[model samples]
Target: MKELIPLRLSILGHPQRLAVFRLLMRRYPDQVPAGEISDALKVKSSTLSSYLSALLQANLVTKTREGTSLRYQVNMETTRETLDSLYLDCCRGRPDLCTSYQQPVAPKERHMTDRKYNVLFLCTGNSARSIFAEAILKSKGQDRFEVYSAGTQPQSSLNPIALEMLKAKGHDTSALRSKHMTEFIGEGAPDFDFVFTVCDQAANEECPTWEGQPISAHWGMPDPVKATGTHAEKSLAFHQAYGVLQHRLQGFAALPFDQLDRISLQNAVDEIAKTSD
Candidate 1:
């Protein structure tokens, strides 16, 4: 409905609710338990209850019972109502702004940051892809970036194949362990400059709010652990994923961040996954 835009935006205007909406959006087409949402957003049960109620009342998200708990999901059908409204509004009002968004920088140009950037990679399990990304950036951008990785529903251990890959590449894996995403929030968490979700199962992943709003993107890929082939095939999957993430990270590292504005920098960060395998 045409009325949904304001209602939806208004409902999402609350910071906690907006975070909840984004967490749900990342997990679109699937339902997440209210408990899970609370854990992911670091919200108290009471605050999350109100956020969910507002989202549900605005029809921005829908929920169903999951045993004793409630599971919520993005109302895709309702989502489209807002999308259609925005599309038509842009077409009718600011048609020039509706055109394809173009990146403002030259592809190969390298830029420098005056200070080290804090970056985080997230995945459902901090085993393979995200671990590799953290390792890769820490290794390559040693002076330029501080890197970390975590999972939404963390696995109890790291993936063996991933460990082998990093070892062969001579990266120190001693500091690596599968960790919960919440460990980075609250207390003395480092403020992040960029956050990327490197898992295909994004719905199971949580997008937390950083102290400062960090640039984020879904650099999603299939989990090598879930690969159903021989050991070699699984390793190859891990290798392929590493290459893609490595390339994307290199591209990110090369961007002249000090020169680009926030919008351009975000576009650059988001373009990496698309441009790299």
Candidate 2:
């Protein structure tokens, strides 16, 4: 067997270091100051400095002096090589799977800010994934997408597991609650740009088309509460679902909805719903 490379070992051995690397990767090619890293990771400057030094030594990150401050950014060339090496190591001699796992190219940015769109998420329980999808889109989408969530049969309280997962991810959930879809369906309900059914039952149920006849989509996710296990086990399920929703919603929010025609907008929603599965 061929020897595994040192860079792969360095990264895989230190989970915290890998997390820092991911953070930098997410903000790729952007020079971030030490304080930002410290804040994001909740690590003290003194502690983070040691990790940063190790990364610099490993050639995973590059540092530049900006006045008295030092900015650190991912060394993309080295990072790419490291990733390639890891892929080769994992696949051993299987070139097909290794080649098939190439990173996807980012979609081209479309300039479409002339109009605004409102989105509504509906589910049977409205307690876990639906609430999470709503909160994430509202926070991440900002002015790009107006978002809300409702339930067919509303729960008396928000799901504790869902709230905990959101707070753990540094998201504010104080303003989130379980609301009835009826509140938004009648005379007072604001017309939605899109209405999404996040549960199978809600998707199949016969209901009046939305007031605005908004584009409708279905995204079905397993109920985290149905998982039978300890509290920790249940929490893990919620966290996993939260991650999936967060990733998909981020992409959906980034779409140029204003520029797309109705058919195009519907297509965009359909594409995003596919990710939920």
Candidate 3:
């Protein structure tokens, strides 16, 4: 136990190694490709290898092969054991002193008004894909970004299938409604920071000019409304659209926005659309 404690401490002592551990911790049960981790942390291949080697020696991480790629995953059980040991040393049998361990709140957990980035999702009818994007982002973004959805030709109401899918996923559907993209035009409209077109038709059409010239991308997908099949098959199409949007939005939320420049952020968003589909 004495030897293992020092070994784990040594592995975590380096800043770069600690950063990699934290990244792997965030991913937890899901393993990440080594290349992706390298890109995300901005560490060179040689440097990352050294860091990963230290972690592996201490049993702080695990690796598995997927097809041709090697994926690294956090050894969460070992991590928790190490933490428990450290806490025991500090508490020294005083149960009251180590009753709970609170994780430090992150900067992104701050109030939305403090540092809110506005996002707009555009589609042909603002019915299914756009509405799904809005709900998913609003729910997952956790006040880090303000999200709105609109269409070139607004529908009178939200699509039923879309509402059903969201509701099944425990998202509130009462207040969601369809609206025209024109609402974002003229004075008093939000100067968006990012804009995403989720339908091929909307992506091909000319969009209204925004005040801030937001970073825009087309995450184009087939319209769920046009799915012509059995009730089960049609509903499945909406579910799939929800899934693709969820994957893309999760990827976006995971980005280190504070560290990435506009060009990099644009590239990341584009890459997500390509890979998520």
The C-alpha RMSD of each candidate to the native structure, in angstroms, is 8.9, 16.6, 14.2
| lDDT per residue as tens, model 2, 1-277 | 1232585456547977776776665444356678878777888999889888888877888999899888887886776677676676656746577633452221122335654567898887788878988989888877777789988888989998888878987888988999888888888787786777776555535446676456666766677868878998998888777877887777778876546655566557666766742
Pairs clashing within candidate 2? none
Candidate rank order under TM-score? 1, 3, 2
**Where does candidate 1 stray beyond 4 Å?**
1-112, 203-206
Error of 2 at 89 (Å): 60
Candidate 1, number of clashes: 2
How do these models rank on lDDT, best leading? 3, 1, 2
Each candidate's number of clashing pairs is 2, 0, 0
Span of 10 residues, lowest total lDDT, candidate 2: 103-112
Q: Candidate 2: where are CA atoms >4 Å away? A: 1-115
TM-score of each: 0.64, 0.57, 0.59
Model-by-model lDDT, in order? 0.78, 0.72, 0.79
Instruction: For model 1, give the 10-residue run with minimal summed lDDT.
Output: 100-109
Total clashes for model 2:
0
| lDDT-superior candidate, 2 or 3 | 3
